[model samples]
Target chain A: MQEELFAPGHRGCAGCGAAIAARLILKGSGKDVIIVSPTGCLEVISSPYPESAWKVPWIHSLFENAAAVASGVEVALKSLGRKDEAKVIVIGGDGATIDIGIGALSGMLERGHDITYICYDNEAYMNTGIQRSSSTPYGASTTTSPAGKVSFGENRPKKNLPAIAAAHGIPYVATASIAYPKDVIKKVKKAISIEGPKYLQIHAPCCTGWGFDGSKTIEIGRLAVETALFPIYESTEGKVTSVKKVKRKPVEEYLKAQRRFSHLFKIEGGEEELKKIQDIADSNAKQFGLDQ
Target chain B: MEIMEGSRAVAEAVKACRPNVIAAYPITPQTHIVEEIARMVADGELASEYVRVDSEHSAMSVCVGASATGARTYTATTSQGMALMHEVLFNAAGLRLPIVMTAANRSLSAPINIWNDQQDTVSERDSGWIQLYAEDTQEASDMIIQAYKIAEDHDILLPVMVGMDGFILTHVHEPVELCPQEKVDDFLPSYDPAYYLTPKNPLSFGTIVYPSTYTEFRYMIHEAMKRAERKIIDVASDFRDKFGRHYGGLIDTYEAEDAEVLIMAMGSVIGTAKDAVDELRSDGKKVGIVKVRCYRPFPAEAISEAVKNAKAIAVLDKNISLGYEGALYTDVKSALYNENGPLALGFILGLGGRDITKNTIKSIAEKAQKAIKSGRVEKDSEFVDVGVL
Candidate 1:
């Protein structure tokens, strides 16, 4: 077996999808990489002064500057005549990617830095106790966007970060899920192999925040892909090159497994809300050709 | 000596330091300095990687990353740009990256003025970076090289901010003797960090410190700043030995001994104050000047010793603390707290591009003399040279 760069003593919760993504990412990139993490769950859990689970070089600076930090590391290596030493990678959460850090991320992609930025999308601000983030799925209830008499949980659709990343005309962009560990590793390898900036958004479910059974993390992640609520695909130079085709599962299969969406089944006009969420899944399927 | 723009002189000094990476975002008054460095990088005169960042926050973040990776790094900004970089500044210092930045001092906004003032960097006094002020183009250029030596010292390993007044020093043209590259290379060697981000060593940086150890880390930074005071003086002495130029270590004095009155100030205002002191001495008024070169690691001991025998001391501040007195005035009072020291008074003037003339300093000195004769101060801190609308 390969040397485990992500050691076993981290403080991540049981069945944490982000922890699985972190282990698999290091496995794919090997030990010849420097990880730049922003302020998020993975950084806080993996590193807590005088102790770290990372057996490789890792740095956690702030919430909104991981891409900028990675750019500096990549250029510093080239300037020091050690460009072949290691690949630079950034592992940030969704709040650090689609929300506060989007400006720096866009700047990095525009500059064409030789770095791979992977954002583990846990949907909400899990580190800050399930606050609503731009990446929160539609009709899902979080602490900040609690469903009630006047509100329908998160009223807006998720931010299309992968498309925004590809719009920068980057070399590669892909989406993966922690349930498919092999695919996650494969995409990480391909991203590092590319010469310019590449972005990958991995759907990593949160068991605690999503109100699901700890053992059901991978099961729910697979449901997200199979139901077409979250499409898994690859785009190269702004064109869709490959996608994970699925025999379409009902959206209810994915929603019923998590308590965040359980309110919809009990609410007064929740069937109409359920139909709206189904339409969102249908839109994703049509756009990515996920139901081949 | 060759006549060069202050910005060009600074760029020349940075080239001599041989930094591995330079990241900067342009703002008013600071644009000329970075532009010259960028041009040199383009012309093949300097072989450093110049990353043009999108904002000042990223500019500092880029420096933090590069410096953590065992590379010498540099950046420059001012005023609102420095305000934008407040969070990253603390992070860089906490990580002990030893990055050097040029803060071309400019006034803060609300009225939105892009003119010369010391409020920008002064606002960041507690961010754990050594703060140095420059009185002229030559001193500003020379301090950049010295800043790197002081910051990269293993005993120190703290970031440094070399502050020069915007438009006053940044835009002025002066005859500056540019140090030869070989001499600078000898005085300041290549950066050899004890710890850095490298896959070969596999170390982590900027870890989250819990309550049990966070205070210890902060205390260590405080101790490092205390040690940096001595390093700053030693580096300046060595620089003077090699280059035949010396600005005093923490505080530079002019005719300060055996004087009845003393004036204290920093940055370009010191030049005007020096002329004012010369006039006062020739008139047999028994006055002198104390120029504060290093503002942080506040030279309280040196300041108290310098003004010990004097009856009254006047402090001129280009920046104010809004509701309170001038920041320097407050610090000067604190320095003189335990001693039977001079009756120190503060005068706020020359803010937001307002000129500080010789006459202004002479009048401030006259006010100090009056307080000495009265044996007490009428007003503690007063704003000088405010014309009624």
Candidate 2:
């Protein structure tokens, strides 16, 4: 309807999950939105000065202040009597959302600003050449947290951002994936319609960073949700209202697909770590009631 | 003129300036300023969006957001709070958002002291902000209105930080003549930026700049700072014309003319220094004080002119550059570099809220007198050992 708010012809890698997710996010937001993006892959690949891929109004200031900037834009509009008309939206990567930008993000939510924050969580710091972020899943290999002789890659499980954001008592919080493009769009749209601070974290598989075939990005994202590695769910007013039901496949169906987790399957005694990851998935399933 | 707390005076001035948005986090000395503004907002006296952010970084970030959208935004903080705001400070300036902030100057920590010092604002000297320091409570109140005018000037759309000594200027009650809102309205018009965030006319801000273009944008900020020096002076002149009060544009002087020894300092210490200088002048020892009001632009030419004739110059600094000397002493010394000026001495005093009595300042003046007589730079960096707590 709005002639593609985020047009093609940019530096996003072919088969980029973030690129697809960003495009759909704009569609969900329609045209009446002021977007704030932090320093990340989307910021680098889309906006390069005189030439920009973003057709809508957008700003990228620092690594961790997009939420703060969006909050400012929200109030500025309120001050000018335009708050009800235009919505404030912030899009950032997991590093900007879960790591460095967490403080400002928490502030934006706790203050109950009317902003829809969408974190394109590609698991690691992909913009800076495949470094590990808190959102990186357990047993996944990243440049910073590589699978060494004694190490089985990233030692910690991915940070549960949806749960964390839900704890803020904001109106809405959801987790979606690029595999379900319509689901992603629906969740973002629902978030935008909410009255106060809302968070939507999309699981975007990084083709280049995650050592996967470029074509398998979407397929792998679907497997992540299917295997309960990234359980898709929605929460309202801090309560888990719904969760994406799955047949509950083993974690290997997800981990074996990506070379980042190959060490856990190949190395001797790696089954112990694999079992640990399975336990993590099982725990997430129990927390969000994904198995039911 | 009524006896009002310095924080209340600043709050009244901000109210008179009529900011559309005020967002800040609480910190020592600076808390009361925001508290008063909050009370005003609650009472419906100040019709503004007062956002209570979680931290100083968010406070500044919120201001940047509000300012970018063409709203008159204001915030206040001190010390570590200012340090927390250091990153967003650059974002506001780099985006060319004209937000006004009052940093009630307080010391930084390790030993965790939270009293008066210029260390916080001084550390952010290179943050691309127009840093203005105030000498007293009245100047602190008056400068906030003047800061809004200077910052929002289209030609000089840069953020301005008005710094006042922590506790000394903020907590102290002083007689202040609050500018009427009618006059303040005439002085500072509503904020209407050349560009803003609107769906109808969208423009990108804070985009990452490549090396090919980054330097030029930074060069523009530098150029804006240079323009701000003149803008600050003109706005101060305009404010003085309207209100019958004068804040010497870049740097304020107290008997610096025809003096043999000149002492340079900033913040509330200037009052004590002035008293010491007058006592020395009456006793027939030539000494005067140069109150540094605009710190960021450094007011290089103005500072050189003020201290050019003095035979001996001593700088009283509450901040140390750690192994290097006082930050202001370094700047003042650099200002006189091209003029073959007198060897200026750096005196570090009153750090972490040490009381700088008239005796301490007189002793500093006496040292300057001694430097003038001996025609030698005796102490390169003097700590002025004021016996510990």
Candidate 3:
């Protein structure tokens, strides 16, 4: 009805998946919201001081404590008797959500605060240069986890943040992607309307860190969803009730677009690595009943 | 109106402060502070939001949010609870919100003992907060009032921590003159946060910053802390003028002039040191005491001057720096290095619930005096009274 809350002039790179994810989230949340963002690319680029691209009330706190900070905002508002005045939202990169900030996030979730936490999963720590994060998919090459002669790129499976959120038994928890713009917005809107802690992890491809064509951000996101690499679903109180499933496409369709996985195709690792990624997706699909 | 325990005095002061929100979890010695506040809120003695936060981290978080929304806020925690809040503590300071907190000083965990000590407050020294150490219940009550003033001051908008040594002062009841709400209101104006979550003016705080200017934002916090140094002195002076009790800036000295031996301490242990000084004085020992009221904005100038004339200085630290020396020992040694005055003795005492008895204090003073005379500083600081199995 009104112009989307995520205005233009944000310094996110051209076609950056996380930027697009942020914009999609803003569109879903609308303008009457206070956003608490953790220190990451979105915060750094959108708010460079003197001027900020965010048209909404936003706060950028430290990296490992955005959820805790958001809880503070919630407490402060509730104390001031302003809880219904505006919705409180938290946005951060994968590192902030999955690694360093996990404890803070757990505390917020355990408290059952009324807020929406959005994780723009760009795979690696793109803001501080492309270091490998726990969420970086197995066999993906990052600056910290280089693909060399006797080793696969990153050796660990991606952290299951959705499952972790579900374990908290929060009111609402979902996983979306930047590729499905309308769907991401729809899920985010649903999350905001929920009473207590709501979490949404959106799959956002990193163009710079992953070495991809900046113009193909949406296309990569779409491929990620179609190939079952990133599924869209929602869980309430640890019970999965709804999912957005699609016809499975080859993993190559998702991997070929990014150079971080380029080694898997070029070296002797592609098939094995692809199998590992497919296994992860397959397990997720089965757990959430995404394949109908 | 009547004599109250230090914890109860702090609790009453917070109640009268009229905080819109009070969120804190209870720990030993610190439990009574929050329990009283909660009871007051529940009985309608105070109209406030009292949150039984799961942890100290959540308690601080709730206060941060409430403060950002233009509500005056307060919380209390000690020892492990304080350590758990290390992350949020930095956030509150960086945001420049005037949320007041009371920390009942106690040692940290790992042979966890819930008793009186300064380890808890001392460990958080570098978190960019205005730290004040109180000697007695009256000072504790008065400091809470002034802490709000100093923290909410426009030039020094930062979180302020009021420290009372756990069981020693927190649970110890004493006479404290309660400042009427009218006086408190005059001393501390209604909190008008510079930045807040208001609809009339839509603004973003804590916005992300690029390397091009991120350093400057952090430096701004440092600048505000430095500004707090001068503001603290002015506020304390004004408070003394109004209340007739002088806290004497960041550093408060007691009978230091013309004394050859200077015993320096902080928190309620200064009370023990003062009694020790009295005993030594009656025996005609040239000894005096200096209490560090403000721990951060470290009071370097005031400390140097306090110990300038003393030939022997013994600094008592309630916290160990682990593998190094005590926290205050390092800071005091560094502060006195340029003056080349006082053969300094570092004594780590009352760590993890060990009581600092008058006899213990006298022994320390005697040892320190002998060390000064012999010119042999006790480089290996003692972790006083820690037992072995």
* Index of the highest-lDDT prediction: 1
The regions of model 2 sitting more than 4 angstroms off are A283-292, B386-389
Q: Model 1: chain B TM-score vs. truth?
A: 0.99
Top TM-score model: 1
Ten consecutive residues with minimal summed lDDT in candidate 1 chain B?
A: B272-281
Q: By the lDDT metric, which is better: model 2 or model 3?
A: 2
| Candidate-wise lDDT, in order | 0.93, 0.89, 0.84
For A1-292, candidate 1 gives per-residue lDDT tens digits of 2788898888899999889899999989999999999999999999978999999999999999999999889888888887898999999999999999999999899999999999999999999999989999999999999999998899999999999999999999999999999999999999999999999999999999999988999999999999999899999989999999999998999998998999999989999999999999999999989997
Selected candidate, larger TM-score, 1 vs 2: 1
- Model 1, C-alpha of A43: deviation from truth (Å): 0.8
lDDT of 1 by residue, B308-363 (tens): 99999999998999999899999999999999898989999889989999998899
Chain B only, TM-score of each candidate: 0.99, 0.98, 0.96
Which one is best on DockQ? Answer: 1
Candidate 1: clashing pairs of residues: none
lDDT of 3 by residue, B275-302 (tens): 8888889999888988889989898888
Once fitted onto the true fold, the runs of candidate 1 whose alpha carbons sit more than 4 angstroms away are: B387-389
DockQ of each: 0.83, 0.76, 0.44
**Candidate that beats the other on lDDT, 1 or 2, i.e. the better one:** 1
TM-scores, all candidates, are: 0.99, 0.97, 0.89
